[model samples]
Target: MTGRSDNRPTIVITGASSGIGQATAEAFARLGARLVLAARGAEALEQVAAHCRTLGGDAIAVPTDVTDAQAVRRLADRALAFGRTIDVWVSNVGIGAVGRFQDTPIESHEQVIRANLIGHLNDAHAVMPVFLRQRFGTFINMISLGGFAATPFATSYSASKYGLRGFAEALRAEVADQPDIHVCDVYPAFIDTPGIRHGANYTGRKLSAPPPVYDARKVAAAIVDLARAPRDTTVVGSVAQFVRLGHFVAPGLSGRVMARFIRSSLDRAERVPISDGNLFAPPRDAGGIDGGLRSPKQRALVGLAAVAGLALAAVLLRSKPAYGRTGHAERGPALPPPTPRLEHSR
Candidate 1:
């Protein structure tokens, strides 16, 4: 922890062109951390780097597709070249596709798995050697609540996140004794970023959950906090925490409840063409290639929904602690047996 205060620690972040990644870059830059920002979009990466520079931190933009192992390796090389010691490497690249499992194309599933799961693996493989050599470094993987539970219409995404979560947990234990090296996983719920609207394709043309989403800035702050303290895992929002708790307390029940909600939402949602002759890209590219959940209205709605869900969860958990678990208490009333719920989409 005792590194140069003036120079700060150098950090490499993937998916740095926008959303949580961009916000994280800015946050670290504000703290004087030298940055090597990587993302697929060169133009957008440059913009983020410029903003980081304006914030009084040195940054180099490396256009990278995390799905490409070679490109990810180059990112690690660039970070090492920038600073002999890379203090942190954050894998934040991810994409999502939402639709009924049968309707969702195989290509969509493959792409998301590559971006969300294999991408993180590529990043870790690229940076682990550097951390091993230095005997000191941190790996931060941007995971999602979807990793913990499945949601309807997002089967591919849920699978990817779940895989990543398992990878992170196993890796943590594998390197537990290495005090000099740290691996942390962060789980955040719907974030108010253009990525939501642009990155995900809703089969029903609507979001399963209501709004009141978290701001990227909030997540960024938490990332910075993680950099300083290095916890094994952290949930970035109340909804995220609730989901985690739900998974632990009543695994099947949570999934079933979430499935019902998702089913209802999709049932009532409007279905529209997801493409305009563009097979690869999602509609509403409204936020540009790298932008996240672009619309202000959508952002507000998501945020409100997140807040409401958290509030309701809190009330339910507090008023009926037994609802999450199935057991007979000696003194209190016996709780009903928990039923499995449909997995939530992250």
Candidate 2:
């Protein structure tokens, strides 16, 4: 089915209670896409669903933990009940642990891997069968630039992102013969999302995404486009391209830069305590899409930067004629080699 038709496609989103997921839900809702929203917080999911309905979109909230394969299957079943078929599944659930590796608990690291990596796997497993049966579907994987660069204090975050990139690559290959079935990977740079506030903090300093934070709506808009016209990969921030290039050109120096920032810049920021923020439990309240950290002036500046970044990517893609087996742009001659991984918009 063509995704351009208004109010036709049924979409499902994990981590839909807040941040990028919440923003994405609203975006698709505005397009008249039927939505199935899932997250650990039922109250928060219902609230988002209500907002979608107010926007004149049909939406159903199903509280789900992506870490649980069974729960994800049930989520798929419930979503199917809504519209009889699922057109898109956005695996957007992610959690972070920020601290020196030794200082962080093993449990915290494991949880990050579970939520960010294995959780996404579960999403694919539950949804791919349906896609294969229907012979057409879009699977959106929400990854970040950390998938390429090694984060110093947030080692677990880096590992999960890197793993996610690999996971998407493998899944793409497995579905190579199915032209209509699409697996889309999205890499967004630092975004002003409630995820930063909800992530676990152990650095003895409040954890925050470094500057040049893009709006969550930017990434959400990309996801909506993927639903309408499937593309293998999309990069949101310009910095993500730079990081991929830097890390490839000088791995040692790139890592050193990250380490220095974590040690000096982040360590010097506001002091905080060791606590697992919403890793194991639902947050007390469902935070909204915007993180509310940046002022209006900062947002305007970032918006311009985001536009410039998109323009640069467009020019580069046009110049470079490289296309991978999946018919998506691949890194090669004509420009600096591009990597498959990138940073988070969230």
Candidate 3:
């Protein structure tokens, strides 16, 4: 609204080429928000921007790699110049790698942390000044369930997500005096998105998201709602809510269950060559919203009751000790690793 010619809310969205970013851009476009879309790929970024324009939103594409603080500063500079003022900034870029701590390359770990954590920091660094100047803005952080609890194979990803949660909390406290400035964090469960296809995989398994996946547009709707009425935390999906509470009340058992599920899933999954995925580079072309997991009828599927039952079972048995006849600790019976029920993908 500041220095703007019209009343359309000006918005900046990063990671705008694919997945939730693209969906969110489309959602806001339909709402008539002026958009500045940024991603690593110029052509793909432009494609999303073009689509937004078709939806009746004013849009421009700015190709940017958020890991570089300077580039992010430039992005902010361009966005502010184009929109006259940034009404909302979505720090939605995230990357992940799936593997044990040692099996995954150090570079992959560093890159994930850089993009997921440090890149978010850069976005905040650039936008906070603009928000302060305007005295009104919303900064949205796209965190995940990993922020609430530890993810087994994805050590770096868990670290980055947790770091993002803490970062958002700190920002919220720092800006408490600013009555109109808002810092919001969104946590979504396993959604059908191309993000899984883009994750680095060192486990040598064909990755697939587990069943009961939600749609990417579900997250987009939540983001749109948050933009309209900013909140401290917005969680998407029933399972995400259960998992967040499960971890808060039963950290030990929750972590153990998650670790076992991932290990068993990987063990039973079909073998494939390890891949670095799109960690260091962007995909060849722009991708779509869905990741082939959700159908028209399947989008409503959510196993929240099943997840709660599992958590209850784990809590009830957490006190049991596994010991052999000699009083030494012993492993429990092997879990049936039939068709992976819980995968280590996005």
Candidate 4:
């Protein structure tokens, strides 16, 4: 259990320029939490900071690249400079790539690993000492469904999320005895972010329909809820829950099912020139709401994915009769055997 203080808590969110991070900052600000927002785009960061201010909270924009340890350290320092102590540090920065592993360049994979995995490490390392000294802090890691279950054409992304999940779980144990520190992991499915087009690359004959995506505001709301009631883990979305169930009931079969879907998506992806240069360009147009709100096209795609997901869920649930049966009966071997008598720390 972590101790709570009455001070206006300070929050530091990475990748705050757009998407989930941006929405999260706005949500926190509305709740009167002081915020320090970080992202690579100075212009975007400033815009988000302005919105946060309009919400009646103090905010500052720090142009940061999470992949850079020095930059992340600077972010922490900036946040500390804002308030006497930090309340929460959220490592929400990440990117994605979609294509065959062989089709994607090695450098691209490395960049993703560095940004997604190493970046989190740097942010945590920078803040852990502060938390330990203050003897009270929370680390909220924004992970993904891919962190727990491997998906097709997302090898590098899967590896990074897996590493991050392990890191968060291990850190939680290490800080168990510390009553003032907390580690929370959040996993969400595809979010309707510019990342779908900007961060992910497709190489095939035709563009594939976007995956089931959620509004950034919804994800941000979940983050705020996590902050108020810190949990060791929280999975975001019905689709994510169903997918997790599938993986648990039939690990082998689930892997095959995911592979088949991915293979088809990859085959249908439009073939395009792979850019050797960094494709982290700013959005061509920006002004209104972020990617979380469903556009007409996105709504149609979501409806389709929802139907398909429901069908898949029904098939998996039927195939495995042992699910939710015999209260204590073991489910399929989706996860490793749980160790009994494990200690729970703060």
Candidate 5:
């Protein structure tokens, strides 16, 4: 355990007002972790902290803008003041912009990079010193499968994820000598979160993570698990593994497949106006952990099943032989008809 035996462990989570961060905070709270929640929405952050408290955690809300380095530093100071020490710092603030790269405004792209990549960097900068002083701490970076695969409409999101993945790797390498100071990355596939509703949707269509979307709690579980058993990387959903494998085996084909999938999903979705949600300001609503967009019963295995079905169909199509109008096999001899038999009445 990261916390002291006498008291609850201290955990600081950014983007705790809603979505995956809120879910993660709740998960840790169940384990009796003292939480310091940070987000732009002060009211929402406080609400989440209250919920955590209800879950048996001692929590304090610290409204902060992670893109501002000084603000993040102040956040760290606030957390230390609240818990007296920090055991884990979760850099979970991330946003997405979905549209054709050229069609999307350059400013929107820059904003994604700033919030998703630079904000995480700021979190590390502010907390690493504290970790060094204490000689033990864990920083969890919430990266998505996009970190490994190039997404078409979400160009900036892909860039930020890729950059964040690299950042975690480098940070882990730098802290390799410190056995207790850990840098961890969580890569989840499409998750059910308000992020779909809050993201900047320039695709001229409604934005939603394609199913089978995993629950935010699924990712949260992995984050909470890190406090006990810290691993360099943890992938939450099976789809993440599949995407990584596909990308590694056939980068060009995988990219094209992803592009086609995005295009189809967007084109089929209902239209929605463009908005830079929570990018320049606080979120309009205190959206809960689950986005209500995905079913809790959904599993990443559904995707695997679909792929397996398609592969079976392809194999069957390739192996089947052409038949004439008589419907006999073209590649082999026809079989003889079965003899008829009569049965006696009992």
Candidate 6:
């Protein structure tokens, strides 16, 4: 149990079972911080906590579903009980489905929105009161480059990321009076995490991140930096910064090129069996700090040509509107409602 005498910074990290969350835990653990780690999978969460303990941190696993507001509130309460003061709360979970808007199921889209956008909202909601009580705490929201740029095949993911940026900005405004209670957003480029492996794939072609993929530990170091010296916004990769600048300079031209590039990549890639991934349930093959996508065997799949084409072309892509012969905007036919799937109950 962490008491006032413990003198270690108390941090709460969601999505702690793998990827950036796991890396962040290890980074803080090396500093001997007391951590409260949360994720949906009980077994995986415990494993992460055990690892953190071995790394010199006092950690406990709290299995939580961020989509549930009450569950998130309980997690906040648990963190408070553990340390009596929540020094930082990092909302780090985001899920996605890769596919055309029409092809993906409605439930899957809703799940993405829930996990990526609303789930973060729940985390903020639960932790805000705690932070207010502490009068000085850092609240970190993990927003990817997707938050700035639109994703072509991942329509729901784009919507959720865009929404998350807006939500974080509005929350920052609301907390302006508290100088010490900071609201921070982190934007990183394509990271080599189990995120790709865990994401639902509606596109038949196998999904792989474009090059310049970063290490998860890099993002973890960024998170630790934020905890020490909180900032309004931090963009981790140079490629991400370039994309943002390009989008600002010529939004229309850059968007079209990015869309075309993704379309070409999907068309040329090899096909694979589609999966719902770990969107509705815990991953069968849970992950660690890295996804191993940068391995030599996997490197062959994403050739240099694709990365060069993507880089030379540009960035940012919001889907184009359907147009009638007369040139008026038109709405596409509505998708049929998704059927009740047994996986939802799990």
Worst 10 residues of 2 by lDDT: 332-341
Each model's lDDT: 0.73, 0.81, 0.81, 0.73, 0.80, 0.80
Candidate 2 structure quality by residue, lDDT tens digits, 271-298: 7777899888988878999887677766
Best by TM-score: 2
What's model 4's overall lDDT? Answer: 0.73
Off by over 4 Å in 6: 1-5, 295-346
Q: Which pairs clash inside model 3?
A: none
**Clashing residue pairs, backbone N/CA/C < 3 A, model 6:** none
Q: Write the per-residue lDDT of candidate 1 for residues 267-300, one digit (tens) a residue.
A: 7878765731222432332232233343677655
Cα deviation of 54, candidate 4, in Å = 1.2
Model 5 lDDT vs. the true structure?
0.80
What's each prediction's clash count? Answer: 31, 8, 0, 7, 0, 0
lDDT of 4 by residue, 1-346 (tens): 1222346678999988877888888777766677899888788789899998887668999998888788888888888988777888889988877677898878888888988899999999999999899887888899988876886676888899999999998998999888658888888876766665456574544323345667666777767766665667777765676677767767789778887976776676667755432235445444323554356776677667667767777777675653321111111111112112111100
Displacement of residue 40 (Cα, Å) in model 6 is 0.6
TM-score of 5: 0.85
| C-alpha RMSD in Å of predicted model 3 compared with the true structure | 11.9
* Model 1 lDDT at residue 87: 85
Candidate 6, poorest ten consecutive residues by summed lDDT: 324-333
lDDT at residue 202 of model 5 (Cα atoms): 77
Q: TM-score per candidate, in order? A: 0.80, 0.87, 0.86, 0.81, 0.85, 0.84
Off by over 4 Å in 2: 1-7, 300-346
Candidate 1 local accuracy as lDDT?
0.73
The alpha-carbon lDDT assigned to residue 61 of candidate 4 equals 92
